[model samples]
Target: MRYACRPVGLLSRSDPISRFDVADVQRFYPRGRPPQPATFDWSFTMNLLGVLPYWQLGPWELGPLTLHSFGLSVAIGVALALSILGSRGQKILGVSGDRMQNFGMWLLIFGWCFSHVFEVVAYQPHIILEDPLVLFKVWGSISSVGGLIGGVIAFLIWRVRNPYEDHIGWSNVAAFTLPIAFFFGRIGCALVHDHPGADATNFVVWEWIRSIFGDSLPEVWPLALQYPDGVPRHDLGFYEAIIFFFLTLFVLYKGRKPQRRGYYLWTLPLLYAPFRFLFDFLRVTPGEAGLHGDTRYLMLTPAQWVAIGMFILGLFLWSKLRNEPLETWKGLEKSTSDDEEPESSSE
Candidate 1:
């Protein structure tokens, strides 16, 4: 929870020299302190339904453990997703929770690698190509799209191994659980001030959200270039968190009795692609050019291009797999009860 050095007491004119503190020392001097920079600023926060909307609790300290927001969010999200997948997966897929969780673990690892690798290749190709070894760096952060692609590949490989598993049913289970991870991941980004919003000074939507929260959220100072209340950036991370929260609710609702079961795989991408594509307009991704997060490709970002492709894939997959029977993992067709009498020998 502790940030950097504590704020130095108000400098007294009577004893300016002796009263000189870290703040005073850093005022004229460059680079601040030697080890830890004196960069602690009071951040305003508000809690809603036990969750902090904008609380910047730097790092959690629990006894001997010290956990950062990104790491903690990842841990919590993975746990929640796996828990739901394990329990709900059994009901839908007839696979034990333990096995489902193990499969999910594989998906996560592969997905994370793909996501990070893709992010670098798309955003910072020069850096990636220059040093291909960077891919092995465990500490390096990853992106979501690439991660999910890798995860899906892992899942498909698992499916090949487990021939008894139902494709549509497993897809539904995955669709239902993924948003939970994304919800927490976005919240982590917001808390850590990772991906900031694009310049909304002239182009914007915070007014709608701002109108609702009003005084609860702090107002940003122009040119602040920071979190909590820095430069009124669009708060894109929080917006994404909101999107995933709603998506989670929708997926859970559909999972109850999916009419077109397998289409969950299709539907999820359809839903997410547009949201991501549109939201990119409000983001500021760092790259060789600058903070041009909106469009990564010739004019569109890699995500936007992927979004367009996903939309097409969704349309194709939905038509092809819509008729898959519900609970295909259990059986594609219902079996006759042993108690029921069979037809007579004579037709």
Candidate 2:
């Protein structure tokens, strides 16, 4: 692929370089409105001869691990997420109390555990037995559902321990943050095109992305790229990123001022669970189809069924919480105080 720069009007101006163009060349405004500048196609050309310029710094002993840019990018994203969370300080559901902070910290730890454990149990069981380095090897294969389960488990356990406390879970906030992580992760995925999925139609947005990246290459490079076949078009990640972005914005909108107990919490499950259940169809899972048509022991994938339960559970909780006295929840008072300006206006 050959890289080309689009010509801006200033760059494309017909005037030749002169001594007058050097210093104090300001205040030259055109009297009339000019035509809108047209966009140019910036692309690069590549062939076998052109693909030799890019070189891998790592050893070729590992088949798929030849110094991939995707891994490095994801590591940076993870670091960014950690930094953001740290800067924000520990808080639970907008209430920055000690109990809430403790709950949030525990929720994150167990959630990480759940996500990884589920990935290992559901898909790659053999890795446990065969690879001594399995712990390190299995970082990327985690299931999102597993993480959710883990986080929920942490929440429930914490809820039990602190039965009197009425506060929203930080997992909801994490759920909001999770997508930002995924957005960055998808970018990494797009950079490497390494996630598992077949090439889609020519008209996909990612197809355009691939083309643009393909064009940025030097004439000769040896970077791992999407072939004509097996071009990883992770549309699921794309959609998930959108969901997370909006959810994050909504959380900021709704939870920034705080609310009564379980308001934002229920909103998350209501929005996420059912949608996730439906979207799971787009995901490629191990043994999705079985001997007897589609496996329906639990009626759907284990994760899908969990999503269904979550949806129903959310509905039930939202109905119950809606009628509860607002004073019972600690965050409602905080919301009232913190958002005193918004509360003063008519509802």
Q: What TM-score against the true fold does each predicted structure earn?
A: 0.69, 0.53
The top-ranked prediction according to TM-score is 1
CA lDDT of each prediction against the hidden true structure: 0.68, 0.52
Query: How does model 2 fare in lDDT?
Result: 0.52
lDDT of 2 by residue, 209-321 (tens): 55667654333222323333334223444455567667667766764654555565577789878767765554444442221111233546666777888898889888877
Tell me the spans in candidate 1 whose CA falls farther than 4 Å from its real position: 1-55, 62-65, 204-230, 285-295, 328-347
The lowest-lDDT stretch of 10 consecutive residues in candidate 2 is 288-297
Clashes of each: 7, 15
Per-residue error (Å), model 1, residue 33: 71
Top of the candidates by lDDT: 1
- Indicate the TM-score of model 2: 0.53
Per-residue alpha-carbon lDDT of candidate 1 for residues 1-347, written as tens digits (9 for 90 to 100): 22233333222232323334555456645673432334423233332211133457569788999889888887899999999989877766667889888877888888887888887777767777788888777468677777777877888888898888666677667777899999999888877766767544443244455467564543332222333443445666777888999998987787666356776788888888889889776677555124435336786777777788888888888888777665444421223332233554333
